[model samples]
Structures are given as structure tokens and as C-alpha cells.
Target: MSDEDEGPLVKKSRIFYGSLEEKERERLSRETAGTGKLKDGVKAGIAAGNINISSGESMDLEERVSERQSEVLAEFERRRRARQITVSTDDAEVKACLRALGEPIIIFGEGPAERRERLRNILSVVGPDALKKSKKDDDKSKRSQEERQETWYHEGPNTLKEARLWLAKYSLPRAMKRLEAARAHKEIPESTRTVKQQELHKNLRNLNNFCSQIGDDRPISFCQFSPNSKMLVTASWSGLCKLWSIPDCTLVRTLRGHSTNVGAISFHPQATLSLEDSDVNMVSCAVDGSVKLWSMDSDEPVADIEGHSARVARVTWHPSGRFLGTTCYDDSWRLWDLEAQEEILHQEGHSKGVHDLHFHPDGSLAGTGGLDSFGRIWDLRTGRCVMFLEGHLKEIYSINFSPNGFNVATGSGDNTVKVWDLRRRRCIYTIPAHQNLVSSVCFQPTDGHFLVSGAYDNTAKVWTHPGWSPLKTLAGHEGKVMGVDMSPDGQLIATCSYDRTFKLWMSE
Candidate 1:
């Protein structure tokens, strides 16, 4: 082919590497060219100007077509970007914007979509700066809307005010004492702390699943160790919660109360140690929307706390043992006054069902995780959300505050565990800790020296502090591990599984 017929060098270069389809079709055509009759037809067609095969003139025509296609694509891309310029889609909003720009709000018979598009084009031509005034107005309206939704005042009984006052008074000293203890903990030499951590790590590495007991006929939904660590309670989908003596795994008592799947159970902070046996020693909530408080001496509930409109996923006792926090599937969490046997605070913040919550050792704050993939920390005294725990890519299933009072660990359906530093107000570490959705997380009740996570992977993992290193993986469950808890002394770990059994792990 002649250089003049080859078109401009730039256009020729664009087609030098022919399209993949053209190359494949050419290869196919060459492979089928064995018959002379086919070649004769092709020759005749080419002479009649019906077919042209890679000739210089055809190349020029192809370049021109390609240039036209390039222009069209560039124009389309420019319009797409312009269309993406921010403009409210509401018809009234579009008309208002047009009015603000001194343009006609309507055209002959233009519908909503067309009117919106016309406004978008105008805004694109004038640029985003033109919307500054309307944007400010919109921002003001949005802020008002958010404020209304962020804080809702629910009038409780007249006792609620007194309860708040009591709580404010009750939490201060505990917070002070906790801060003092944290300071003393920090005063310990790093060398000593390191040695202690190493010992803990060694013990965790030595952990072995020693006993597995079928605690229920159905899947166990939750489990917790009593404050004294001598007893463990497992709640099951069979609607019963069973109390067992730890180490021996012997059934102590079966609390028959919930009429449906028992979703959560909690032992009072002072249960079996200082709290009276005849008082409220344990609290359990079920999918029947009932919360029951039981005494250690009775096989029946001592008090039936009601008010939840949906399933309660988790219940936790305040360190003071005066208040109870329950998370529900209704996207709300409530604080119950045990003395009054009434809900004192009905707080709504989560956009999805609240899955789990834990109280800080000081009892001044509560951290809750939800199916919305977010966790929020509420200041108990002021009833305000002070910190937002974000970063998980899927629903957060469990959350627990560290003994240090400033660190929080959350396990999520994203198959990861995140540690948030409240002092820094951000997520500090993300541990890809499981092969399946994480169902529960717990910190060592004494010093937060280690963390435990249970997951649908049929395994429970032990992680040591300082570096968040994996120390051991307890892998004996035949089904998904639904819950995990560490003994108060950190000497033992208990896990409940969907296999209808609960297992005990201890240093061997």
C-alpha cells in the first residue's frame, strides 16, 4: 500500500494493532480458504466494490470511521460527567433551584425526569458555585432534621429523674477509682508488664478443650461465666437456660422461664460473691420479648421484666448492679431499673437490630454493636453517645470493653475483629481473625491481657495483648461457635456452639 493512501501516521498507528475480533475472524477466514470457489467469489465481490481486504484505501476509510467514533465517545463522556454534577432530584427542589438561578422553572409539558435533567444541564453550564446559596439553605435544613432525629426525649416515670440523679452520683466514684487503678497499672514497669504478658501468652498457648457437654436439645444461643467463675450459664434455642458448675461441667440447675429461644444471659457483677442468693442473681432475655431476673436459690424467675417489643439479643448488668442494659431487635436498647422493675431509658440509635452490648468496668459507659455495621458508645450518666465505632464492612455481632477502660473490641460478620482506642477515638487495629462470621468477643475480665473470639468457623481463638498476636485456636466444636467468655481470673475459657453443646477450655 502507498504511504499517501495509508492516511495520517497518527490514525494509522491507532489501527496498527487490529482489534481482537478482526484478528480472530481473519484467522478463521484463512483457515476456511481451501476451496477455490470461495476465493473466486471473493475476487468477484472485491472487483464489484462489495468487499475490501486490508487495502490502503480501505485503511483510510477505516481511520475516518474510527476518528468519528472517538469524537462521539469523548462527547458522551463529557455529558456523563456533567450529568453527575450534584443536583437535588426532587421536582420541587429542581424548580426552586431554577428559580434561584433566574431561569424558568418549567418547560412545555416537561415531566419530572426531564425537568431534573434540564436543571442538571443548566447547573453544569453555570458550575457548582451557582448553588452556594441554595446549598447553604439545604445544609441548614439537614442539620435541623439530624438534630431532631439524634435526640428524642422519652418521658419515663417520675422516678426516672431520681434514677438519673442516682446514676450520676453512683458513677462518679467508680469512674474515679477505675482511673486510679488504670494509673497504677500504667505505673508498673514495662519490663514487669511484659513478663506478665508473656506468662499469660504461654498459658493461652497451653489452652486445650477439655470438656464438651451437650447443654441443650437445641443450639445454644449464649453463655456467660458467673462473676466468681465457679459457675457457667448456657442459654439455648430450646427456651431454657442451664446453670453448670465449671471445670466439672455438672448441671447445677435448669432455669425454666423463657417460652422461646433464650437469646442472652448475664450474671450480676456480684452474684455468688457478695450479692444475696435470694436476690436477682442472673438476668436472661428471650425471643419472646421477655426479660427475666432469677435468684440463685430458685429454679423460677424472681421477677419478670417486660417492655421489649421485639427479641432481645443481649442483656448486661451494670458494675453497680443497680441498672440493666438490654439490646433488642427493634433497633433500640433500654436501661432497666431493677429496683423499680421498669425501663428507665429507651434509647434508639442503631439503624438495624442491636445485637450485643457490654458495660465498661466503671459502669459509666456502654458500648453496643448492631446489624447496621456500626458500634456506638453511650455515656451512661449523661445519656449521650460520646464515641462512634466505625470501620467494619459487615454487621457487628459482638462488642466488649477492655479492663483498661479505654480499649474496645468488636467482632463482626466481616470475619474480622477490630480494637478501638477510646482515648484516641478511632479504630486502632483490625484483626482478620476468622474464616467465617465472628459471633462473639470477650476480654479477660481482670487485666485485658488477652482477648477471645468465637466464630461460625467452628473455632475459638485466643489473642494476647500488646501486639494482638494469636496465641491459640481451640478447634473442637462440630458446628458454629455462637458465644465465648473468659473466666474472671482468665484461667479458663468457655464456648457455646450451635452443635447443641458447650465446651470448656483450660490450660493443660
Candidate 2:
């Protein structure tokens, strides 16, 4: 099959050289020299002897030795003067002087004399004014770092203002309702909670493989369930979004608009529930740097949103369905208003490309995890970062806000899942989940009691949240698992994999 480098069907002999090659000879010689420490032309010796002198010679030698000693003492004194540090100020004044010189005012295990010496050494540099200018600049930078950012407002039309206000109105009630649920949740008797958890465990323990079906011609990159939990949408590398019947695993629809590999697919929150069949009910982002809104009956996209500079990796809608958020390879995330059809915020904070993001259950906050191995929680209303989730050591591939509303879960290429608490602003637990990259994590929406994680290790793991004990690891896929989701009723778990298939797990 060779052409340019060789004639067709010609076999070439492997090249192996003997010692005649200059480089080979030089390499051997260098190795020998390094290990043997061989040297050339070395044969010299000095005889050991002592002087026997006459009286006159001894007297001359004494005078010469005395002069040499005096010269040595003078040289020593000169070096000592160069290194010596002297200050006439008191101890406190000495510290103040050191502070002014931008030197340490106090050092551990150092006495007052040592402190004065440090001050003098600093004065040697700073009094010369070379360090003073640099130190002043450093101090100014420190002051600047200390000053927090004030509020920033984006001037928009009255619709934007109304949107923000409406979000506040909508989210506050949801948040309060969640809080009420939380309070009632805590009020449950410990014995009853234990029994209920046991029952939940009984259900979770039966999450064995039920079915596996070829989902696409190419690898499925993501899997999402409709709001009604009646259908499964699998976005594939073949640039197709496939819809399949739940449990029965039958093909229902194939939406085709993307020209390149589809990277992300998500169903609208109101899809198949309250939304019309003619409206935009599905959203997909692809490697061609576009986000397309799709409908159920049509094979084509209803609306095309453009302006992404690079491949869009993830797209999620605001819970209210008014805005859509996306992460792109351009090292930024963007918020687009669905009603206004304009970009509201183009947020850039990740050092590398952003990968995955999830909105809080109440819709006021969004958590974005990136290839930089860091995650950020942003306040959508205020356009300010509220917290930094920075512990993952590899690219964060997935982020999920817990149903509890205050805790967040993130999966990473580091083969771990970390649960973070918004109230405490710290990681509460780390689950050493997989032998390979953890591709996705989804909290079971039933009672915030369990989480399901899928990994490149070709398995999906179910975990109990409070103790984070592994409930079970379901292994059936032949390739890396790319995405996972649980049903709204918590009875089914679907995982899509690089093997061009999706699997469902059913409890006994």
C-alpha cells in the first residue's frame, strides 16, 4: 500500500547499525567514560618534607610570617565590615525601621541583635532605594487585592429588569418551599427515617441490569430523560439525537439538525408535560459550535442560536425556561435569554474550556465545572460568583446540584465525586468512585438520599448520600460510560456509553 516513500508492495529491511556509525561509537564511548571515570595524562606526585633552618633564616621566616598574619587579619576585618549590620535605634524603633524597609519585623528564633542585623541588611538594599520602589508597588498590589469588587449592573431593557424580578419572585417561593420540606424532613422521627431508608435501600439494592439497546450508529455522548420521564434522548457522535421508549427500548423519533458530532442534549423542563408539542421542547449543542432547539414531531430544529466561538460542550436551561446556559471550548460560559433572543451574560472565569454546568433547583444559582479542574457557582441574578468549588485534580466533566438545594455534587476525570455544601462553602465528602474517569453524577430526585455516578471504567455506581457508602456498582457496558440519569420516580437508571448503547437498571 506504500506510494511516496516506497514502491507498491516493496518490503524494506529494518535498519540496524554496527559500531562503524559515528553516533553509535560516540554513545558507547560516553557511557564507558561516565561509568569508568577514565581520564588521560595523570601521573604527578609531590614529596612530603619539612624545613630545617639556621638561626638567621628562622628569624627572617618569623618576620615574614608576622606580616602575612597581619595581612590576613586586615582582609578578614574588611569582609566583616561589609557584612556587619549596625543600628542606633531602640528595639521597637528597629522593628519600625525594618517594616519601613519591607523586611521582616520579627523572625522566629531570632534575638534583638539578629533583628537589628536583619534591619541593617535590609537598609543596605532598600536605603539604596532599588528595593523601595518595588516594595511600594507590591504594597499597592496587596491593597488592590484586598479591595473587594463592588456591584456591577448591566444596563438592559425593562424586560431584563422584569425578568430578574420575576426570577426572584419565582425562586423565592420555591426556596421557601424547599426550606419547609427540609424542616419537615428533619422533624421525621429517627426510627421512622431509619425504616424509610431501609425501604429505599431495599429498592436500590435491586438496581440490576434490565436491558441494553444499541442507541445510535456512533457513540452516545449524553443521555437525558424527558420531564415526564416517558422518553430517553441520547445525543450521539453521529450528530443525531435519538428518542427511545422507556423500559421497552423502542425507537420513537430521530431529530437531525446538527452537522457535526452532537456533544450535549437536554429536554426542556416543561417538555411533554405542560409545553406544547409544537414548541421548542429539546435543545442540543454540537461540535460545530451551535445550539439548536428541537420539537417532538419535526425532524428539523425549530430555532437556531448562533455566536459560540467554538464547540459547545454543554447546554442547560434555567428552571423557569426563560434562559439557557452553555459552556464552550472558548473558555467561557454564556447565558442567553430565550424570550429576548439575546445574550445576557458572557461569563469568563475558567482558565481552560468549560465542560459541564447545572442549575440550582430554585433557579437562582448555576454551578459550572470546567477543564481547569475547578467549579464555580454563580448568582444568575447578581452576575457575581458566589462560591468556588476547587478540589478536583482533573477536568471536571459533570456538575449536579443536589435536590436538597444547598449541596452540590461534581464528577471529574480524577475518578472521584465530591459533594459540596453551599451553606458551609466546603467539600463535605469525597467518593473515590472509579478506576478511570468519572464521566457523570446524578442525584436521585426522590429524597436527596442517593447519587448515581457513571465512569470510564464501564460501570454505573449507586451511593447512599449521608454516609456515601457504595450501594452497588452495575457493570454491563463494554465501553466507557458517558452519561447517566435516574427516572423522576427513582425506579429506573439509564446509562449511555461509548459502545453505542444505553442500559437501564431496575430495582427488584
Best model per lDDT: 1
- Measured on C-alpha atoms, candidate 2 has an lDDT of 0.84
* Each prediction's number of clashing residue pairs: 0, 0
Candidate 1, run of 10 with poorest lDDT: 56-65
Compared with the true structure, model 2 gives a TM-score of 0.74
lDDT of 2 by residue, 1-508 (tens): 4456774344232122222244544755575455333222111111222333334342343465457557655654443453554575599988766666666788899989888777666555445364456567778988876563322345666665676677788889999999999999999999999999999988888778898999888999999888888899999999999998887999998998888999999888899999998998999999989899999989899999999979899999889988899999898898888888888677887878999989999999999999989999988776678999989999999999988998899999999999999999999999999999999999987677999999999999999978999998889999999999988877789999999999989986
Per-residue alpha-carbon lDDT of model 1 for 1-508, expressed as tens digits? 6656776874565465346436654654564454345667766898998886755563344455457557655655556566468777788988988887888998999999988888888776677687787678778999999887574655667767787788778878977988888789889999998888778788788899888999999999899989888999999999999999988999999999888999999999899999899988999999978999999999999888878889899998988898999999999998988788777888899989999988888777899999999999998767789998889999999999998888999999999999999999999999999999999999888888889999999999988775888999999999999999988977789999999999999997
RMSD of 1: 16.8
Clashing pairs in model 1, backbone N/Cα/C closer than 3 A: none
Q: How far is 222's C-alpha from truth in model 1 (Å)?
A: 1.0
Q: List the residue pairs that clash in candidate 2.
A: none
Q: Which candidate gets the maximum TM-score versus the true structure?
A: 2
Q: What's the true lDDT of residue 299 in model 2?
A: 86
Off by over 4 Å in 2: 1-81, 85-159
